[model samples]
Every structure is written in C-alpha cells, then in structure tokens.
Target: MDKRVTYCTDLEKSVIMSNFERRGWIQVGPEDEWNFYWSFTQNCRNIFSIDNGYRMNDNQIINHFPNHYEISRKDLLVKNIKRYRKELEKEGNPLAEKMEVVLPSGQVATRYVHLDIIPVTYVLPADYNMFVEEYRKSPQSTWIMKPCGKSQGTGIFLINKLSKLKKWSREAKIPFHPQLSSKESYVISRYIDNPLLIGGKKFDLRLYLLVTSFRPLKAYLFKHGFCRFCTVKYDTSVTELDNMYVHLTNVSVQRHGVEYNSLHGGKMSVQNFRLYLEGTRGRSVTEKLFADMHWLIVHSLKAVAPVMANDRHCFECYGYDIIIDNTLKPWLVEVNASPSLQSTTHNDRILKYKLIDNIISVVVPPDGIPDARWNKIPSVEALGDFEVLIDEELMEKEENGCRPTKNSRYR
Candidate 1:
C-alpha cells in the first residue's frame, strides 16, 4: 500500500506549503480524499458544522477544534477563565487563593491571586454598568478597549476617562443596549501602563502552544517563540494615548509606523529576552517569571478544556500573546487560534518554517502518516524545538504508578 501522506491546505503561504513539499506530501483539494488538511479557522468551522454533514475517518486529521473560540475569543476566554477560577474556589483549591491587590487609586481589593494573570476585564455593553463601577473605583486607571472578534491590534484603543468611551461609542454608532448581540461587542481591560521595557521600548511575547487533545489535555510549548517589539519608545502620557506605535507590540500595527525596522522586523528572540531579564533582574526572579508564565498557560488551557470540542481528528497550534509588567509579572494578553505564517525577516522565516515542520512531526505518527486514532503522544525525537508543556495522562500514570491493562482503550 502507498504510505505517502496526501495533504491539502487552504493557505497559500510558503511556510506551510514548503513544509508540505519538503515532506513529499501530495497536494489534494479539500473535497478530495486526504490524510491531512491545514485549514483556516473559518474553514474549520465550515468543515465541522452540522449543516455540512462531513465526517472524518481515522486516517484523516486537521488543525483547529470545532469550538476553539472558548479560549480564543476575547470575551469567551475571560468568561471561561472566570468560571474556572470560581469552580476551583468552590472546590477549596489553594491555587484559587485570594490575595489583596492595590488599585491605581490606592484602594485595595481581594482577588484570586493565581488566576489574576489577566488584567481586570469586562465585556461590553452587557457589562457596561459593571465596567463603570470598576472604573469609578480607579478613576485614574487607563483601560484598553478591543473588539472581541478582531486580531493584530486592530480596533484597539486606550481610554483613561469615561468620556472617551462615551465619545467612542457615539462616534462609532454603536448601540449601548444591554441586550445587544451584535458583532461589535468589545472587551475593556485595565491597561498595564508600566510594562517591562528593553532598550527603552515595550514588547510582548508570542509563545506558540500545540494542543493535541483537550480532555486529559496534552500540550507542547515551542522553545523558539519570539518577542514583538513596539517600533516606538514606551510612553504613558495621556497625550500619547492614540499612538499605537507606542503601545501595541503587534508587528502588523508596528510595521506601519515610521520607526519600523525591516532588518530585524522589530522583534527579539525569547532567548535574548530571557538573558536580558536574568541579567537585569536576578536570575531567580527571572526564572520565577517564566515559571509563572508556564503555569498560567497550562491553567488557561485547563480553564477551557471542558468547553473545547476535543475532536479526535483535530489539533491546534495556538499563539499566546503575553505582556510582562515592570514588576516582572506576566499578564495573559490573548490567545490566537491561527498565528500568522507570514515571516517578516530572514530569521523569522527560518523560525516559523521550523515551527511548521516540528508541528507536522509531532502531530503525525511515527510512520509519517496522519492517523487520528493513534495515541497523541509522539516520541522524543519528534519534538524538535518544542517542549512538553503538559501530559495529564502521563501525570496520572506517574502519580498512580499504574499501567494500562490490555483491555483498556488508549486515549
């Protein structure tokens, strides 16, 4: 029997196509029989939709889960995380321990310390009154408003005053009805004004995580994730509020700025970032920061695992955007279902190409064939630059010291 993997992809990007070509995978149309499909998030929805009535065999696999928005959508992510924390608190988990947090107005508030990775956020206009209440408590605090469905720092702006929100709503012709279900919904989060700066400029980390399953979640973190730097220096003056170049570290937004550099594409390697942190801050503190980041990433996935579809044929590579404050606290900015395949520089191209190659290796079985029924765990040789983030099944086995019986079905 022919064992060459037949693949299909809706994307025309070189990073993805080249990887497929390098593996000698035959290209097939979406409607044709194929073992693998690299699909867009929208295409995934269509493929998995009940109306489409599409079914996959054990030999087929694809990227993205049916309900990935559980942790990808800005609003849903916050809702799921809040729900996860509450459930943990109800179970009396020490991980959900509450701690006192000081507000910008010098007032103190108690919050779940472990899950406090994300900033104080409220989805609007449903939470309009709640946002107002929180805003009044810290009248001087700056909050960033982002469209729930958008990406790449689009439709994002900072507001330090209530009037700015009102003016924005009015000018954008957005209805303030509490029952509104329009796609124009936004999430307003407290801005981390005092971000950790490198070379006097602000940047955000872009970490890639690959999830093979949701229930008994299996995940891997890519080691070569990079940091996207803002083209301009960090500034907190109210006058500079509209300067996206000063606040947004998204390469798409930064590339439009006059200070954008083509040579380096305004990016820094995460290794260099760690070195700088360890050198500037103490090594222990820097280590703790990275540890905390990993903890939050795992918990964030756990938060939405209950809601994820967890289809056997689906696996997703997510881009997690994170920002670290001046105090070395890493904040969960957002998660992307489909990270950009577009490389901005030569190094970036190589990194992303390797990323795609590693993803294929880990997802495909040892035979180099896509098989959804195969155990999700890949051999150490397949992991390339990716490190195992979590394997709940392996954790369970280690904790119990029990091996599966012959009759037991492998997950």
Candidate 2:
C-alpha cells in the first residue's frame, strides 16, 4: 500500500479530507512530513493553496517543491481580460473578428471575443480614462463595476450613467481611496443586457475546470455542472436596474431574494439545461454550442498558460461562469479560482460532495499515495463527469506509437 501524508487546513474543505480518510490515506499535522499539502495561502517551504495570487517568496519556493499547485494570480487573470482585445487584435484570430468593437483610436476591433461571454472590461485607473471616452460614445449602455480581489458579489454595482463615476471620482479624488486603489480598483465592464432567459429570468453557468498541469496545459470541463438563476425576473427598466436580485446570478446575492427556492437552491443541473436547449434548439445546435464553449475555455487557458508558474504536484479546480445570449452564443464572464464548496441545499451538497470525491480520484492514486511524477493522462472513467481538453502525456504517447484505444473516452 502507498504511504504518503496529505494535509489540508481549511475546516470547510473537510469534504475533501473526509474522502481522503475514506481512501485510507494518512492525514498529518502541519509540521509533519507530507506528500500532499493544501491550504488557502501558498507556503514557500512546501504547500499548495486554493488561491491564485502569490508573493515573490512563493514563486521562489515553487521551484523547490517536489509537487505543488500554482496559485491562480488574480492580477494575471485581470490582465488576461483587460488586454484580451489588444492581444487578440495583434494575433488576428478569427475569434477576435467575432467580438467586433470600434477602438477609441477609430480602429475597428473585431473580436466580439466571447460575445456575451466576457463583458467588455477595462482595468481601472489605467484604463479608466479610456473607458470613459468609450462610454461617452454611448452613455446609455449599462456597465457592471467589480473590485478585482473581492468575491461573493461584494463591491459590485451597475451603472448606466457616467455621472456616477464622475461624482465618485470627484469625491474620492484622482488618487482613489486605498480601498479602491488601482490594485483594488473596480473592473468596469459593459453589462450583459439580453441574456438567454429561462422562465424570464437571467442565469449563468457554473462549470468546473480542473487543471492538473499548466505547462502541458491539461484541463477538464465537468459535464455535471449547474446553472445559477436569478430569483427575480430579468428586466431592463431604469427602476429595476439597481435590483441586484434581478441583475446578478450569484448565489451569494440570490439567497437574499424573497422568492429564492430552498429546494432547488436557485440552480438547475447542467444536464437539465442541456436537455432543455436540445429540446428547443435541436441536438446538433446544442452539441455545437457546448463544443464552442469547450473551445473558448481551451484558448482562454492558452492565453495565460505561459505566465502560469506551475509545479508538478499542484492541481486546481476552477469555477468558470459563462453566460449565453439570446443568439445562443456563450460569453465568458469570470473564472473563480476558489469556488465555494459550501452546500446550501441538498442538491448542492450532493453535487459538491461528488465533485470533491471525483477530484480526489483523478489526482490521487488507488493506493492513496500521490505520485507527482506519474503525470500520465487520466482515464475518462477516473475523471467521472470531466473530460480532458489538453493532455501532453497523451501527445507523448501518440508520438511514441501508443495510441489510446478506439473506445477511449476523451472530448
């Protein structure tokens, strides 16, 4: 039997630990020698964190870790969206042509990028003035303002007028409050207005993405994700604009809704959503739509793969939120590094429980020991609901004349 200690600190992460113990893996204290270590914050000595942001010391220690997961850097993720228009413009990818937007320089930007997937976002303080000029062109357009580092629907609001920003700027002064400092400055993006509605409500997809390696860029998209529905019906009327329950699909915000369902948890299974779309849009169209979503995800990972400081021992499961428009095109909203594992309802508990279990199965060996160097492509059966997007080991196997079986499951 394999014998290697695994460590995790967050009590809320006990779901993961419970499964680890069930697998007969020994759990060790912080000071003990361990093969797998999980924490919320990165440790230089030998640790992995759920967070993506890191310090220089963390990077320096990263190289020495026999196995370590790279923390998702928030600044880097912000930059990915902020500079996406520019980068895709330079590359001239066809995807860019789809996201057409006229630059302030009068340069027509073709890259509707993800259409409604990613709201046209600009990094504030740096891009604030530029966005202001763009907004002046259409002051009636609604925009969502969000703080870079905060989560759980915190520091988010919608604005349809430029005067509010101007007023905030005037009061806070040009320097902006340290609370709203450039690092913490709000990422203001054009709000997605006409979302694909179900029962006349706005909703977004919360899909899980697991990354076992970054350099090789192996990822998996969970098929059994869910849709977060806003409790209030979506409306564009001026009076309803500030109603977060109508505008936001975040469960954290939706729970406060008087109409929120305790049984359904304001969520629907992704399978059910797929079935609904298939019934309405036809099978071929639905399949292609999901395939396109997969495409967007792979490329997004590629965009940040180079800058990701990866360690062999590290693995991460990201919560990716995507929104679809009336045209059935999926838009990238945001990627959450540490998605809440809390189970607010029975359905939520079951899905999250299975999610943690499957993740453990994919990353940990049968003997309960983690072999960081065993970096082979995971079998689909081991992945449960997830499908591999990019696997370097698979490529290596193919190059060496070892093709996977015809019945092999990979998407």
Candidate 3:
C-alpha cells in the first residue's frame, strides 16, 4: 500500500495541511488510516509531535529500528528557561561563566546563567519568596512574570512593587481548587530595562528552527524570520508599567493598540534589521552578532540533545524569540513549540507562506513519504532559507575517512 500522511482534527484548517497538499502528499481522513501521522499530541502511531519518551511516543524509533539506527533518548521541548539554565550550568560549559549574577546577600549565582543571553529567571512557589526578598532589595528594578506553559503573552505581567505580588498571590489562593488556586506557578525574571530600540519601540526576533533528528542532532535555522515590534514606543517609567502596548512585543497585545499598523503589521524582516545594524554598527560587529546568535542556538540544542528521545518520523519547527540588548547582545527570551502561522500583513503572508513551503521542502522526501529504511539530510537546494547547524551523519562521515567538499562552508 502507498503511504499517506494524515494530521489531527485540530490541524485540518492549519497552514501545514495546505503545505502538505501543495507538496502533492496524499492526505488521508481522520479514520486512523495512514502510514504517517502529523499531530500535536504524542503517543499516536507513526507520529511527529513535540514529545518523545517511553509512553510519550513509545520510544518508537528505538523499539522499531534498534539495529537500523540509534536515537538519543531525551526530551527536547525547551519551554522552561529555568530548567534550561540548569542544563547549561554543567561544569565546563562556556555559557556558564558569562551569565553570572550577584545576589542581594553578596553571594554569586551562576545556576541561572545562559551566557548573558537570558534574564535571571526563577521558578515560582519554590523561589517565590526569595524572589520577593530580592525585589525588596532592588525596589527600583523591574521584573516580569510569565506562567510556565503559557505563551502569546498570556498570564504575563510586570511587577515593580513586592506588595502587589503578595496581594495578588493572596487573592489567587483557594483551599480546595488546587488547579485554580495559587498552586498554579510562574517564572519571574529580571526585565531587561534597556533593549535595543528601533524607531523608539521595543521589538523581538521570531527566528525559525527546524530539528529533523536528535540522535544525530540535525537542526536548521531559517533565515527569513522577522522582528515583531510594539505598536507604542517603549517606556520604562512607573506610570507606563501596565501598558502592554509599550512593554510587550506580542502581536496579540499590540494588535489592540490604536496605532497598530495593519499595512506593515508593525514588523520588519530580519534581513532588513541586519542591514540596518550593519549600517549603524559596522559590518564586522553585525556579522559577529549574527554569528553569536547562531552560536547560542547551536549550543542551546547541544545542551539538550543528550536527553531528547529521537524519532525519525518526528520533526519540529520551533519559533525562537530573541531580544537584543543595548550593548548589541542577543538574549534568548523564550522558545515556542507551536508558533502561530497566521499572517496579518502582506509581508507576514509572504514570509510565513514561504516558511511553511520551505519547511515542507526540507522535511518531506521527494517520494512524498519518508523512506523508513533510510535517513538522508536535505540538500542545499531543498533547504530554501534554512541553514543546517549540525548533521551527525556528516560528522560521522568526516570521522570515517570522508573529506569535506568545498561546499562545506554551507554545511
């Protein structure tokens, strides 16, 4: 029987379904009838989802193809910066040394470091009171609160006063409803008071990352992502603390602003941002900044590669949000597992449409179905704007008497 691909009911109207249709891949009905399944939920047979583990995806690649290939058995969904920071703190990791923080008590802290690439984030309930005490010491500093699993700026707020957090926590407390009560936790991080501003507005980068394999750790970075900007100019004054339009760069938050531009969508391409940086910061500085971003991504994946459960049938395209500080440093804000693909502007439509298309080009084989018997990396022609960061198979080849071709620069 010819293998066909099927997606979950939720994705019936999603852009990915259309991308698959464009590729001429036969889409089967939701009758649990297909050789390949594209789903957001884990544990479906022959599936591609965010999670992979014993019960998660049955460690299917290992159980099904033990002799064929070895898969790394770890969880790669990097949603929690707190846990991610812990992983990077292992002895000898170079990022560990660069992200040190001094506590109010005069002790040095490196447990939450990511090479000056992240704000000092602490998981709540456990670190809640300590964070409150820290805030007490630095009343003038601002901190942002983010729920562990929520995204799109949901359940996010800024806390400038310790008393407000205490009152809010008290109001959120419930006796029996554990799920509804203060039992719900958050991560609070020191806000970057000074972000690199464009046109007097705060903005962030939404870069695309495609990970095809984990055991071999094959990953790619799409070069065509754009910078999302706030509709209002950034303001750090106490009076503007509640103005999400000035503080947050989320499209959901900014779209409500009166000045939100529907034509340009209050966003610009990363390439244009790069050009602007080059014009202002010089080419060498701009080049180093981009290189540093690339380095941050490659090492971030490397930190979690060992624990990710690899499934050949599964591939994930992550949206990595990054912020550039005033000193020309790129700080990783967060990573989204299911980034919104909806486009709100002409440029957005063009970029996202091509992003999905390019993702299809890189992932799907020429035959419309991945050959279960073999694994092959995408060629440069199929990569579109995606650049491969690392390919374990290629590394293995070089280890076993293969010399890199002149085109190795692209690899």
Which prediction has the highest TM-score against the true structure? 1
lDDT of each: 0.91, 0.70, 0.68
**TM-scores of the models, in the order given:** 0.96, 0.83, 0.81
For 1-411, candidate 1 gives per-residue lDDT tens digits of: 868789999998999999999989999999899999999999999999999999999999999999999999999999999999999899998888998888768988788777787999999989999999989988999999999999998999999999999998889888677876655899999999999998989999999999999988999999998899998889899889999999999999999999899999999899998998888887999989988899889989989999899999999999999999999899999999999999899999999999999999999999998999899889999999999888887777765767653212212
Candidate 3 lDDT over 1-411, as tens digits, reads 964454333455346677767656666654544444444432343333234322223111111221111111111132333355555566555555454566655655554334455666665666655776667666777898887656789978998887777776767662222234355567678898899999999999999998877677778889898899999888999999988999899998899899998999888999999999999989999998888787677666665666565656567777888898898888777766667878798777777778878876777666555544446577788899888777777877875777764224323
RMSD of 1: 3.4
Provide the lowest-lDDT 10-residue window in model 2: 57-66
Candidate 3: residue 230 lDDT (0-100) = 95
Candidate 1 lDDT for residue 106 = 90
Residue 171 CA displacement from its true place in model 2, Å: 4.4
Candidate 3: RMSD over Cα atoms? 5.9
State residue 152's C-alpha deviation in candidate 3, in Å. 1.1
